[model samples]
Structure formats: C-alpha cells, structure tokens
Target: MPELFHKVLKAFSSMKAGVLLLALLALFSALGSTLLPDSFNHLILFNILIIILFFNLSICTFNRCRRIKRLWGAGTGIIGGLRQWSLIILHIGVILILIGGMINNWFGESATLRLAEGEQALIAQDKSGVGVNIQLEGFEIELYENSMPSQYLSHVSLYKNSKLEQQSTISVNHPLRYEGIKIYQQSYGNLVEVETEGQGQVDSSTVLEGQILEIADSKWQVKVFKYVPDFDLAYGMESKSLQPNNPRVIYSLYQDKVMAGIGAAPLGEKIEIASGYYVEFKGIKPYTVLKVKEDPGLPYAGAGGILFMLGVVLAELKIFSKPGQGNGNRKAVVE
Candidate 1:
C-alpha cells in the first residue's frame, strides 16, 4: 500500500502528467463552449478534469519547491535559484487563477435591473439572502451624428434600510461599486405614456412603439405607428426624424376595423379629432438597464495575473556572466 501511494504521487507530479491534464482540460473547455445548454455529463466531466489538474499542479509545485530547496542548499548560485523560484511562482499563479475562476463560476451572483427614473429595486432577490436597494435617479444618452447612440449613462443611488448610502453615474465600461456589488449601465429605452378622454371617460396607458392600445369602452383603438425624436415635414408629408430635438409620436386611429386618421402629435400636446375624441401624448420617460454582479474571487484573479507577469520578468533576468566575459557586461534575455 505504501509503494502504491508513492507511485501515484510520483506519477501525478511528473511534467508529462501535467501536460496531459492541461490538454484534457482544453479539449473539454472547447467542447463546452460549442455545445448548447451544456449537458450535465459534460459539466461533471469538466469539473472532474479541473479537480485532477488542481491536484496534479499542487503536487508538481511541491516537488519543484523541494528540488529548489536542495539546489539552494548545494550552492548552485543565484541564477539557478532565481530561475527555479520564477518557475515555481508561475505555476502557483496559474493554480490561483484556476481556483479563482472555479470559485466565481460556482458562487458569483449576477442579475439585471430595469428601472425608470425614480424607481428602485432590490438586488439578489433570489440568492445570497441579502437585500441591497438600487435606485435610478436619471438616465442620459449622448447621440452621435447620423442619430446613432454614442453613450448611455445612468445616475444611480444606493440605499440601505431606507437610508441613502452612495450615488454615482455609471456608464459603459465604468461601473459603480458599493458593498461588494458592481452596477454597470447596459442599455436604455423610452416609455411612451398616452391618455385619451371621450364620452365622459378618461383612460391612460403606457406603451412602447408599435403597440396597439384599446381606449376604455370605446370603439376606437389606437396603434403607435412610429416614434420620432425630432418631428419634421418633408415633401408636403409628415416625416419622422431620429434627432431627439422635438419628440413626437405618429399614431393611427382605427374605428372598429377602419383606419380613421393618422396624425403626428408632439409630446405634452393634446390633439383633438373630428370624432369627438381627444388624445394627449405625455412626455417620454427613459428606462435604464443595469447589470449587477458580485464576485468574491475577482481579487484573487487580479493578484494571480500580477504574479504571473512578475514571474515572467524575473525568470528572464540574466544574472550569470558568459564564459569569457565579466559580470559587468551581462546581457538580459527577455522572452
């Protein structure tokens, strides 16, 4: 039993075993990325491979450390010592990175929050058993030429127990962090509010463009044909433009299956029709989409990355003199 245990340890600590494990891990990772829905069997296989790789890496690093100690004791000089230490650090850094990734995949939390101005929501409602409230103060969008979106910004505030804690504007690539959670601005959209009054009744509905709405107990139905951030008239016909300078909605009124009238109404304006019905296009409200995430292993991954770079730098440092040259003229070889 003792010999068998020793053999198992020796085999796992070998360079060949480490390379084989790495190849298997890469194969499974590629397969997982290409397969849809990620089968349970594949996930189990990948996790098992990771576990084996972890054990193999730990054993190999231990063996290398022991060898380095022996070499240092025998006075193999500083160059050899530095080389061995660099290799050991590189291996340890890779192991930490793998461990960090596993921890993030298994325990991290991610969720999306869609909020209009002055709206608030609780984060991680289904996991972690902690409630963090996030509120949207405002949302802004910058438009470039040709009416394309240049950037999106969301001004947000954090609350704890109904008390304000933090406030910041989060944009793409700029995330807001509070209490271990990061909120990133993901997207934005417009919400249109329409109000109609006819026959001693008032009805209101909030809708998006291209949505059909039925007025309360009336034969008239309205469909939002299109939304124009800037309303214009071209070639004697009403046209919609993308600039948000003057926002308007082009609506189609239908009377029981027959198109009655099509009109362009600006936001906050009331338009009266010949059929004794009045419609008001209330102002548009901006809705912001935010992605919230909490990853406890991010710091570990960051540290591993720094250590990996440092190891590469230290390993390439030339401390040994050439056979015929002195140490004063030693050249550094960077790989």
Candidate 2:
C-alpha cells in the first residue's frame, strides 16, 4: 500500500497527472449533466472528489519543487511566510467552493405553490403543518415603454398558524425569505378569452368572450401564459404574433399522459386532433408562480471563502530567498 501510494504521489506530482485529472473531471461534469434523477448528488460528489484530488496533487507538487515555494510566497501575505503556502491557500479555496456547493445542493429545499387572491397556502409537505403560509393579495405585470415585460410583482403576506408574520413583495430575481422558506417570483400570465363548446348538450355551441379558468379538476387546469397579436411566420421556423388587439396565446395544458400545448396565433385557431372534447380559448386571469426554497449550508460556503482568502494572503506574505543576501529584487548567490 505504501509503495502504491508513492507511485500515485509521483504521478500526481507530474504535469501529466494534473492534465489527466482535469480532463477526467471535465468529462465527468458533462456526463453528470445528462444523468437522470440523480444529477445534483452525482455532480456534487464528483465536484468534491475532484477538488480533493487536485488538492493532493498540488500539495505533492509544491512540496517537491523549490520554484513552487517561491511562487507561493509571492502570491499571498499569510502563507507567503512558508514555502508553497500559496498552493495550499489555492487548494483550500477550491475545497471551500466545492464544499459549499455540496452543502447547498444536498440540504436545499425547494417547492412551488399556486394561490389565488385571498388564498393562503403552506410552503411544503409536512404532517405537522408547521410551515409558513403565504396569502396572495394581488399580482401585477409591468411592461416597458416598448410593451415588453419589464417586471413582475407578487403582493403577499406570510403567516404562521394564523399569526401575521410578515408582509413582503416578491419579484423576479428578488425572492422573499421567511422561516427558512424562500419564495421566488417565477412567472406570470394574463387574462385570456375562453370559448367552450360541448357536444350533445351544448353541441356546436361556441361560448366566446369567456373569462379565464383557474381551477384544477380531474383533468387539466387551464392558464394563459402570454398572448401575441399580428403574428408573423418566417420560413421553417414557428411564427409569432402578439398584437394585443388580435392576441394569440402561448398556452399549455399539463395532464397525466399528454402534455398538450399550443402557441395559438390570433389567439384561438382550432387544430384538429382526437381528444376528449373540442378546444376553446378560455378566459384569462393573472397567474403567478412562486418558487420556494430553503438551504442550510449557505453559511458554511461563506466561511470557506473567507478562510481560502486568508490562506492566500498567508501563503503570499511569507518569502525565503535561498538563505542568501539580495540586492534589491535580485538574490545574491551564496558561494
């Protein structure tokens, strides 16, 4: 075992080892992305493993090489007192980031809940129901001068067991955090027209100018994501039309088997397909999606970063020049 360790150390101390390890890590990262259901776990584990390997290789190489020691001293203030301290600091930083990511990935909790105005919902699955409940007061979408969406906001209040905890606003990129729950303003939808026509009882009946439907039933729920009018069609590519006066919705319907969706140009044009019933453009109402998440490992990651930086300073501040005198920047060779 010791002999094997020596051989491994010798290989890792070489440039070839660094190159090979980097290549392997890159390949594993790419492969990890394509893995199903087990992505975060595998990716985090691989990341930490590679960091350890790199640290070992760096330490071994630094200990064996004199030039490495001088470079480490030149790089940081604290580790600068010792030979190869910069290498150690650099290794520590890599380890910190890896560990941070691992903790964040493993312990992070995320969920999503839909609530209408005056509706309150708890954030997670708990038997005790001891989680925060968020009440959706109102939702709005603001457009830029060019009519493009500039911002989306959700007006909400958080409560814990009937007690008003806080009133907060959430927006894209800005999340609201309370009681270990983070709510992200993910997306929004507008009011749309629903035209429902049934067979037999309401055969050949078209109910245009219908209001939006926001109820979940045994089948699929309907929601209006976006509408575009004056849609244009280019060659080969799917066309887009978003003239408000003649709006077309990019809508989706999620079901158990079929995930049916349509980018209905001019809003409601019937595409003939065999389904349960005929399709219609239902009414539109505002829809807001909130992403809730909690992660316990954030502090550790932060601490690691600070330690890594300190290590860097320590490694660079310490310098030794061959036990000889130096003329300004030039070291005098001791005979």
TM-score of each: 0.69, 0.60
TM-score of 1: 0.69
Error of 1 at 118 (Å): 0.4
Q: For candidate 1, which ten residues in a row score worst on lDDT?
A: 326-335
Instruction: Assess each prediction's global lDDT (C-alpha) against the native.
Output: 0.76, 0.58
What overall lDDT, based on C-alpha atoms, would model 2 receive against the true structure?
Answer: 0.58
TM-score, cand. 2 vs. native: 0.60
lDDT of 1 at 26: 80
Model 1: per-residue lDDT, tens digit, 1-335? 99999998888878899899999878777767777332422366777877788888888888878877877787656676776788788878878877876776678777888899999999744255556688999888776876677889898888776778788999999999876778888877677898987875778887877788776667888887766776776612333434677677888898895899898888888777546677888877769989888877788888878888888987777646355432422221111
Query: What is candidate 2's lDDT per residue for 57-141, written digit by digit as tens?
Result: 5565456345644544555322223424444565556556656666767677777776556778877534685766789999877
For model 2, the run of ten residues with the poorest summed lDDT? 326-335
